[model samples]
Target: MIYDVYTALPTTSVKEVLGTFEKNKIGGVPVVDGKGILVGMVTDGDIVRFLSLQEKVYFTFSMAYVGETEPIEKVLKQRMNTPISEIMVKKNLKTLSTDDTMESALSLLSKHHFKKLPVVNGVGRVVGIISRGDVINRLAKMTSDSLTIS
Candidate 1:
C-alpha cells in the first residue's frame, strides 16, 4: 500500500516530462487532468517512438539547404517542446482499484507484462502506482520473515 506517487498533467510539455523522468529515474508517468483524473499515460518508450516516427518535414532554411538532412538531435529537440496530451495513451487504460486484491494486480501484471499498475479510485482518479519492484520486495520480506533459520 505505497501511497506516495508522482504524476504529470496533460498540458505538460515533452521537455518538462523528460526532465521529471530524468530526475526521478522513472520509466513512465500517469497523466492527470486538473481534477486529478487519469487522462492518459506516458512513457519513455512513447517519446522514443514519437521521435522515430516523425516524417522529416524539412522546411528549407534556404534554397541551398532544401531537402538537406537535418541533424537527428535537432529534430528530436524541436519535437520535445510539444504538449504531451498529443502523444499520451488516452484510450482503454487498464487500472487497479483501491480495494482490488493483490492477486488481481499480480494477474494483470503477468498477463499484460506491464512494469507497473496505476491504482485509481471509483472516479478514475489516480491514487498510486504498484510496481514489480514493490511486489517483489513485499513478497520477499514476507517470505524471509516467515522462515525459521535453525
Candidate 2:
C-alpha cells in the first residue's frame, strides 16, 4: 500500500496532468506544492465541470438544453486557467498515515466517496495514494482468503 500511491506536483498542467492520470489509469490526483505539502486534490469531475460550458455535444438529457451556448472564445475569456493551487479543494482532505490500518482507510473512502486519498508521513508529505480501486482490490484479496476457509 505504501508503494501504491501516485502523486502530481502543482505545476502539472491540465493536459499533462490528465495524460499522466490516463497513463496510470487513475481517477484523481493530489495537488502538492513544491515542498510536497498537500495543497489540494483534482478529480475528473472538476475537469468536466471546468470544460462543461464551452462545447455542446449531443444532448443526453433535457437539462442539456437548458445549458447556455456561450461562444468558445467568450468562454475561454472568462475561464481562469489558474493553477491547481487556485482551484483545487482546500478543505476536507481525507488523508491517511502510512501506518494507518486498511480498515481506517476504507472507512474514509466509503464515507467520502473519494477516489484517492493522500498517504502522508509524520511531516505531512505525501508518500502514497490509496484509491478506491486499491481498496476494492484489497477487499477482493481478503475475500479470497475467506472463500477458501468455508
Choose the strongest candidate by lDDT.
1
lDDT of 1 by residue, 1-150 (tens): 557777999889998999999999888899999999999999898888877744445455664323445678987778988899999999988799999987888888889888888899999899999888887887899899999999
34: Cα error in model 1, Å? 0.5
Per-residue lDDT of candidate 2, residues 36-128 (tens digit): 888888887876677566545556656444455887666655654545555567787889998999999999988987777889889888888
TM-score, each model? 0.83, 0.76
TM-score of 1: 0.83
Compared with the true structure, all predictions reach lDDT values of 0.85, 0.75
